[model samples]
Target: MRFGILVNEGPFNHQASDSAYKFTEAVLRKGHEVYRVFFYYDGVNNANKLSEPPSDDRHIVKRWSELAKAHNLDLVVCVAAALRRGMKDELLAEGFRISGLGQLIEAGIQSDRLVMFGD
Candidate 1:
């Protein structure tokens, strides 16, 4: 199956990001394809390249970055939401890009299922 994930909250503030990450991993492990992982609202924080979590704690941003790299994932941060949150183009991680809402709409239209994690 083809999946599209939509995240709506910032990393660390809620379980939404973590859940999305785990679900994405599980889906890939099951041999399903993830068409796109779109970050919206505060979720764009997940793509922040400057995030530095505690040494002993999980690095949410890095985790997502590595996951995207390993899977060749399409990780897109909503341009409007990311700009509002002060996430600049230069600060985006390797596998992430800032894009318009149309990208999200197109992903949803192309995927076999759209899963949303938020709050």
Candidate 2:
């Protein structure tokens, strides 16, 4: 089955992001297809390229980026949610471009299921 996961929590502030990552790995291990992983609210922080966890702590951003890259997964962030939460990326803050719900709609329509994971 094709699955799409949505996250709505921050990395360090809560375990939602960590849990999502593990769930993602487990899903891929079972040979199920993941259509996209959308990060919204505090979860958008998971996509911030500038995040840097301590050496002893889990590097959420790096792990997330690497996992998506390794599996060629569709990692998306909700625009309204992201912007409201102030997790702006360069492309977002520069001119407030389009790359949020449009991507989510496409992913949602294409996937067999839209899975939500968060607090």
Q: Write the per-residue lDDT of candidate 2 for residues 1-119, one digit (tens) a residue.
A: 89888887978888888888998899999999998888777777787767667799898888887887789877777878877877666733211222567777787898898877776
The most accurate candidate by TM-score is 1
Q: Which window of ten consecutive residues has the lowest lDDT sum in model 1?
A: 79-88
Per-residue lDDT for 104 in model 2? Answer: 74
Cα misplacement distance, residue 70 of candidate 1 (Å): 0.7
**All candidates: TM-score:** 0.97, 0.84
Candidate 1 lDDT over residue span 1-119, tens digit each: 99999999999989999999999999999999999999999999999889999899999999998999999999999999988889989999888999999999999999999999995
What TM-score does candidate 1 get on C-alpha atoms? 0.97
- Model 1: residue 27 alpha-carbon error in angstroms: 0.1
Q: Please give the lDDT score at residue 35 for candidate 2.
A: 83
Whole-model lDDT per candidate:
0.94, 0.77
